[model samples]
Target: MVIPDLGRSPRPAPPHVGPRPEPGSFRDPANRVFHAGDDVLRALDRTAAADWRALAASSFFPPLLTAGKVCGTEELPAGSPLRELPTAPASSGWATVLRHERVPFVSHPYEWSFAMLRDAALLHLEILRAALPAGFTTKDGSAYNLQWRGTEPVFIDIGSFTPLRDGEPWAGYRQFCQTLLYPLMLGAHLGLAFQPWLRAQVDGIEPEQMGPLFRGTRRLLPGVLTHVHLHGSVQRRSAATSTADVRAQLRDAGYTRELAVATVRGLEKLVRRLDHQPAATHWVDYQHTCGYSGDDRASKERFVLAALSAAGRRRLVLDLGANDGRYARLAARHADYVVAVEQDPAVVDRLYRSLRGEGERHVLPLVMDLADPSPGGGWRGIERASFAARADADTVLALALVHHLAIGRNVPLPEVVACLAGLTAPGGRLVVEFVHPDDPMAARLLANKPDGIFPDYRRDAFETLLAEHGTVEDRLELPSGTRTLYRVALP
Candidate 1:
């Protein structure tokens, strides 16, 4: 199949079109991304254009793009109207423009669960393996290059693919270890969460930082000996050596393409075998243990469905603190896309696996703490957007979440209401549940806090704050009289 090309337009180019340059896309000089309204366009220099030509012609490209492993791409013929955008790199004139299929939402590795990151790593390796036989390979291994289409991972940076060179080691090997392999190993072997580390260091965990974590017998784990222990030792020894010198040495030592292929194969096998079975957390089995009777549970579900129906069809839905994605699955029936944000990694992992197994493609599960969500990070803190910046859901389901933030996290009721209001799109609806202070669950949350510290944690206070924030469209108290649900519409 040939790549689709939009021929040059007969009409004149738009005057002073201002396409916003992606702040995170500046690292690569050969190709850069720009957003012109709804279109996601990539500007390719002469060299990158050549690479794109090779990629478009490759036999593997069509199949991967068809299978959704790679982003759907089409070339804009030379002199196309989009080429004249103001944000196009003027220093080096672009030879061609390519448009990519936009993902529903952009999420970072730090916000992903263990399974999500592992799957992304496997997809990266799969792409490398597929490209090797066709004389092409990825130039970089960054977790950022991968984005999710619900439960599926798609490689977005088509510019990373290039014709392979003879006797050159895998350029992305160290990067693969740093970003993908080490993070997975940290979770699988140590049962430690890698999200915070990744959030702290966008470049990912280095071998030096990871090696010392494994002590004594732990160093003998499947990939630890070579990838972590010895790799760190080598990096420490070569700290002063120039990268050019290392490449020259490897070339002189006869490191062949076959070696790179073998490395890719080995990494794939190792990654596939790695698994993290986290110890049971409080929220992992919340659906079964949430203390809701049959009637109460059914009533809650009916209320949520009614709220969703009242809102009509939604472009996007947010399920904050989605315990096991029960309501996220429900919201999916009424929305184009649903983002299920849960703080517990294990719970999110289970949700992701179940969605992947069932071939569900509408609900995207994410591991994020509502108390401390993802922030603006990377170069100048604008390269990667904050969670609040990315979230603008038309329908937000904040079920069984307010108590956690207020009583558990100590966030005031007004602040919680304001935060939820900020997440709702203009003229959108928020379905939030407020657990009464006398409820068993709320009592458990308040058990450790000093007595009378949260006297204002009353239903009246919450409703007053909600009224101040938006119009209360509907309200329902559960049969148990322990929880109240409100469907508020933002002005």
Candidate 2:
């Protein structure tokens, strides 16, 4: 059956209006980000404007922009209407506007896998290394400044680049250690997940918090002794020292631009050397272990392909519980961009490494728990957007995921369907799989549960819930008859 266009139409782009300041951008007084309609803009003060002019004229910037290592940026014409918006700095009373190429998605470091975060850290350090040689350095070392274009990491904060002073120490040193360096160390050395720690404190793990965790021999690790232990000690000892006093002391001690260059070089070496291999999880090999006969697997693939093709090309496709990324890659064939969301970090890391090696630029893998996804946080919960806030997918692939949410997570089947429906954009499609209660996978999940629980876990109930959310355009029962796939079109 053909998938009909439902009553709801495609979502339109943002309307053109006066520039609205981004909530998280208030911290940077010299430069602030604004959104006017579909354009992403930045307003800079007098000092920041001078820095921007120098950076635009720099020999390094053009090459980086061409290489896709940095976001594409251009200063708007002086008479542009966007410049007249009330986005000027309070003290400067004037603004220089620049438009930035928007990223496909904005994901937090906490939602990234070990490899993704490591790559971001490396990118940050690499940019710093390049900038220092050209007498420029980033004013801050914030992981938030980095965004992804598919698998590629791009530095988005052009305002951070500032001219290097004569004898000034690297101003963002402490921030780098806390945000990027420590997180990498946490994963590589301790084999611990850094997401929870970063989510708990948006500023990242403090030196003091990290230093105490490394005991005895662990303290001798590459960057521990100097960057963590000594760094924390110094911070504590100089808690009352003013910023001016510290810079004066560093200058008095013969700190020079050359020293700053050395610091960046040392950091690059350390970051490159640090490697993390997550312990293998069950989901990592799910594609091979999943109990689907060759013919059944083929049938499932054909069904998914036909459904996606019938729906026509998609702007964005979200694959929930994308284990091994087999289906996400398939969805990519019909999508402009695909976000493969999986809860297991190890599985996502493996998928990311494979995609990166293949140079697959359309599929982006992220670590996210469907049950408890990333939430809005910082400055009254609007600074960092939640996954739900950003996920407006044209097509949502929920293959082999409903049982996990219903039986494993204990979310009611209706609620599970509702959540999936909510993620689907208007006039979007939901390709979902429902496993029978007697299915082996569903049986295993139910084995530990008390008797008579989840009594409503039936195929009929699932289809009824699906109908409540949208029109079930098509359905297919696999050869095994234990699993069924449904294609629903939302209004």
Each prediction's RMSD over C-alphas, in Å, is 3.8, 4.7
**lDDT score for residue 216 of model 1:** 94
Taking all chains together, each candidate's TM-score versus the true structure is: 0.94, 0.95
lDDT (Cα, 0-100) at 14 in candidate 2: 63
Model 2 RMSD in Å is: 4.7
lDDT of 2 by residue, 290-333 (tens): 68889889999999999889978888899999998999999888
Write one digit per residue (lDDT tens) for candidate 1, span 48-148. Answer: 99999888899988899888888879998766787765434356577888988878778999888888999999999999989988899888999999998
TM-score of 1: 0.94
> What TM-score does structure 2 among the candidates reach?
0.95
